[model samples]
Target: MVSLRLRLGKAGRRWLLLFHRWAGIVAGLFFALWIGSGLVMLYVPFPTLTETERLARLTPIAWDQVAVAPDDALRAGGAVGLPAAFNLEMRGGEAVYRIAGRDGNRATVSARTGARLGPLTPEGALRLATEGLPDGRVEPVERDQWTVTARYDPLRPFLKVALGDPAGTELYVSQVTGEIALDTTQFERAWNWVGAVTHWIYLTPLRARPELWRTILLWLSGFAALGALSGLVVGIWRLRLRRRYAGGSVTPYRGIARWHHLFGLAGGIGLSTFIVSGWISMNPYRWFSSNAAPAEIRAAYAGAPPPLGLDAATLRGFAEPGTRGLRFVAIGGSWWIVTDGLAGTQGRRAADGLPLTVDAITSAAARAVPGGALRAVEPLAGFDTYWYPHGADPRPLPVLRLRFDDPAAIWLHVDPRDGAILQRLDLSGRINRWLFDGAHRLDLPGLTGSRRLHDAAQWILNLLAAGIAVTGLVAGWRRLRRTLSA
Candidate 1:
């Protein structure tokens, strides 16, 4: 029995060494690229149009020309019940109602003539793209490297317009919706090739097919996790603290192998966790559910379609000089108007045109989660465990957190200003937050509270990871040469 146990142990050690060595050879380069590119992404995130930026450029809604009432415009747009999304904004110097129905239909109705508008022509797209800037050129494109992701699917066949500005900015206007879908500057385009593009493997051809891209990421990250785990185990087994090596060193290796041993011992656990978390991000078994509020749940919360009972004069009174547009929202069985402008999004009572009171906002949040007893309502003035800002996407602060007593133990974060649902977290979602964001982004509550501390910790860990990869590459190269020579 003793002999058999010894044999099994020896065989296991041999297999572990072989697995770690060969896995390193296969995935070492990619690990290095991921770590390096992740650092680059820390500072220069992928270019995106933020809500504030989008609203800043939009001309204030032409309320004088808006002869059609909000209710009349909905009828003209052929909306049955409360539409999925009802946005009134200026498109190419015309105030239009963009109504998205729950039945997967969309319509753009002119506010002036109450006429349904069709898709934009190339000339119209160019005009929309260069609304505020000097137009340089316009070219129609189906897909490109920057606009290859599936999120831009609804706005396909974009018209790329170059603005002859100092920033070398290019805007992509949706031919279907005539909205400025995306904008990229020279600096953002140049850095993103090595940052987000390489980090996410977001090359146009691969990313165009989202499922294939996800599959590749799943398999590759899975293997990388395997490799990292094996290395971590091997590292711990070989590390000697009390009883040192023959040469009074903790590791039984020389030169590059010694560096690899030391770095692996230091950073292997973190590297393994990061890789595992990245694998989890692909959602291997579909264990995590989407956090979006369901259609029925949202409809229940809305209570009824927002009434456009207010007139043009009343609506015009709500606007300031830079007010971009106004949206009709249903909150707690009452209609409210949310104004988007230079001052940011603010809610007003549709009937009285008064600012939304705190009591009203809190009352509306109670109706959001039906059939669940309201356990607690916590107001978050800053980042917390579940509510935190991501890179380039700053989550609105001063949010109202509603906890429910449902089987899912659901939590909802509502915008205090507009009573909009910002995020929904259930049992599975909370688990995934730690598995993905906590492990991968180091976004723990303690670390996230202080930007300086988070940045410092990440930099130190990333440097150690980079060292491990560099030494692994050297060792792998040596092994390859020896195999060839042998």
Candidate 2:
């Protein structure tokens, strides 16, 4: 053991030190960028216009114009199979039924004429935009790369309308559904260029293709992880548990090199942890596959519909005060009425506005997917891998976790709160929770409780990581200066 230690300390470490030094010099700027951007991320997340914000901009419900019911609109639009979900919303002062099919197709049916809204012409798309935003001046619409990402999927070929507001709000109205799909303010756009865009290395040219973007980020972060690992090895080798250099300073290296060693020792594990976890997020091997049985959801999860004769007047009684819009979801073979409220989560069946029971729900969920058998109906009161809202998904819980028996290993998260299917996690998605979301965010159950606590821990860890990167930057600059002068 003594000889082994001596051999490593005397000769083995020198080569490692050399390699680490060169690698750090080459990749140090990116490390500093990742750390600095990561700190910014702890406070200011990637920009998004929340659903609440979008609803606030809408005109109130015009009950006088409502001629057709939600079910009538679906049939009018020639909806294929039972919709996995549907949003009963008003577009342009007219009631419109936006139906999302189980097969990922979407269409808007006019509640007034019961006519399916056809493909949007430039004039028609502009008319829709103007109706939604009366106060703001508009730019001509473009159906281009803006809404081509996964974030805006199922809501595309959008009519991009830039509002001349102080915040530079740009609203992307979905051409098919005639609904505002995404709203981005000026601050979100500007800050994101520095924060999420740079941090994730998400350039549009590269990120336009999902597979290509994931691959690029995976390879880049992979190399960065390599750089961090080598630095950790060298940092530990030069660490001073007890002994010091000639002047009795704790750090054997001088100046920036000393700071690099000091902070690297302090936060090397954190640096390595973040890089590797970030790489894992891309799912390079495609382990967890989304095994959602949509056909099963239509068969088992759907309830027998209320007669189409039920009209708009019936819905009037259900609307509460300050309600921007209403969405009716059919889950577990029952119709649940959902509307936005100040307190949030106002739910009851359409038949009698009665509170839902658990027994009725679980029975419907059991039929949602077939194969092996029923697993535990788990409640996600706390953050786990998949159910927690990492971004702008406002499907509030108390949510239900439905497990299945098939070899694909399916887990369906149903929202009992509003009878909405919140998330469908297959085998790959379950693993994704631990590997990507778990590692990248470090939201270990033991480490986190409330979101406030999670943010605090994330801040402390990220700050230490920033220190490591900054020290490396300083050292690399000095080293480069010496080399250039020599």
Q: Which ranges in model 1 have alpha carbons more than 4 Å from their true place? A: 132-135, 358-364
lDDT of 1 by residue, 1-486 (tens): 999999999999999999999999999998999998888888889988888778866888988777777888889999988877777789868998888777767788998899988877887876777766755688898899988977777677889889888888988887777788889999899889889899899998999898899999999999999999999999889989899989788889899998998999889988898889989998887898778777766776677745777655677777766778787888777788888888778888888888887678667666667678778988898777888887797899899888889888888888878888778888999999999999999999788878788888788888888888999999999999999999
TM-score of each: 0.95, 0.83
Q: lDDT per residue, candidate 2, 235-305, as tens digits?
A: 88777667866777766787777888888888888888888888777666866565344665656777666
Residue pairs that clash (backbone atoms under 3 angstroms), model 1:
none
Instruction: Give the count of colliding residue pairs in each prediction.
Output: 0, 3
Q: Where is model 1 poorest over a 10-residue stretch in terms of lDDT? A: 305-314
Overall lDDT per candidate, in order of appearance: 0.85, 0.71
